[model samples]
Target: MSYQRRLHPNLHMETDSQIKQPSGRWGQRTAYTKAPNITDILAELKLGHRVTPVFAHRSYTWELQKMLRARPRPVFDLCYLDGGHSWDVSALGVFLADRLIRPGGLLVLDDLDWSIATSPAFQEGPETLGQFSSDEQQAKPVRLLWEEVLPDLGYSHFAIHPNLGWAIARKRDTKAVVPAD
Candidate 1:
């Protein structure tokens, strides 16, 4: 008998990981962005056979939802959501991750208070609220998800690890029923 573990569709990928180098000339400026592209990261990390890497460059509904529809359920033990900063996008990720994560699985969210307008961490954006005032920046999506959404979704409240700017939650156990004679 042989057992082979398959990479989830989200992590499986095939790509040409060659990024063109820049000449750094006046006409040919630097050909690099602040963040490395998905293919670049995959090649750098050497995650070829371990998992599938789905670059969700579009709306969650369009990308994640379509993927979920094709793949089997309860496939993931942990999901880290840190890409999108808006409430709606984060909420969508959480909802979808809920279906993908197995029972007793863990879900982690990043950027407890990470809006460009509200966060003091970024100096370039306009400050809607006072910087480092109430720490309301921490409350936007992080608190709303941890304090409100998780409990409603049958996930136990885990500590929001502030140092790493993440909130963790675990799927709760199902209620047991006693047999009646």
Candidate 2:
């Protein structure tokens, strides 16, 4: 949210996430901040009118699926994906977001270097061990998507910032036509 604020101050952003404090490591941290969700931060900053917050009742992936089903056409110029870093959640979410983003729009994937094995929150969990293989746990899912998925989807001007742990790609401008020789 702060990054979006800094990048595009006037942009009216639609943010989606589970309303409750998250279930893992961040949930414990939220107890200290008292800002359980984005809603609280919006209230504190008084940016409610500028930013639309959609709280997911089920999960972020479910909410994104709902958005794709309900919306008739692409609505956002920039789709910033920061939720659901795992392949199970993110792959589907990014695919849906591709449809949600308008032509010539930007798709920003955050935490490109993130992986279950490296994440302190999930590294020691039995659930993580069962769900992800050793390679899957170590694999950078977002970076994998950036390289393997987005290129196949035909997005242009791909930029990867390893140090910053994020990547950006632009949906092709469908309206543009090439000149014949």
Candidate 3:
């Protein structure tokens, strides 16, 4: 459900040597120096749980598209988009997640507040992109985006984490038919 750093052997070995432990399930380390790992999603799928992990960057997109295109339709029950932070990218991510999620499925957006909190660079007229921009000129747009624009979209559900940012969305209607394989 979330990305985590890979601990070095020295750190991991200290935990327990006696027991045969279950391996961790999340993706590869955040650096992306190595190949992408979706072991968590794979494990979930193996257990008959649906999963969809978005890879917004070019490198990840190439890999993700290949994997998704080969899978049966409506393969995901939920999606969490914590990838890129650009406005365009965020919007696209929401759109894509909307398409992939099953009706009544949840879609979580990490760092939505982060963009609003730090938005001096990308300006939108009189307002800043976030609530706390470095420049006064930028703060208005930031507040407007988070407080007004996002709400106007009628997402129907939202949770704001003081440290983590926002989780915004609405569940699609479950009455819609899922395509038969």
Using lDDT as the measure, the top candidate is: 2
Against the reference, the lDDT scores of all candidates come to 0.58, 0.70, 0.45
Of 2 and 3, the candidate ranking higher by TM-score: 2
TM-score of each: 0.59, 0.72, 0.47
* Ranking of predictions according to TM-score: 2, 1, 3
Number of the candidate with higher TM-score, 1 or 2? 2
Two-way TM-score contest, 1 vs 3, winner: 1
Which runs in model 1 stand beyond 4 Å of their true positions? Answer: 1-48, 120-139, 175-181
How many angstroms is residue 171 displaced in model 2 relative to the true structure, after the best TM-score fit?
0.6
Candidate with better lDDT, 1 vs 2: 2
With candidate 3 superimposed using the best TM-score fit, by how many Å does residue 23's alpha carbon deviate from the native?
Answer: 36
Q: lDDT of candidate 1 vs native?
A: 0.58
- Tens-place lDDT digits, model 2, residues 89-129: 88988888887888889999888888888776674455646
Candidate no. 1 TM-score: 0.59
Each prediction's number of clashing residue pairs: 7, 0, 10
Q: Least accurate stretch of 10 residues (summed lDDT) in model 1?
A: 12-21
lDDT rank order: 2, 1, 3
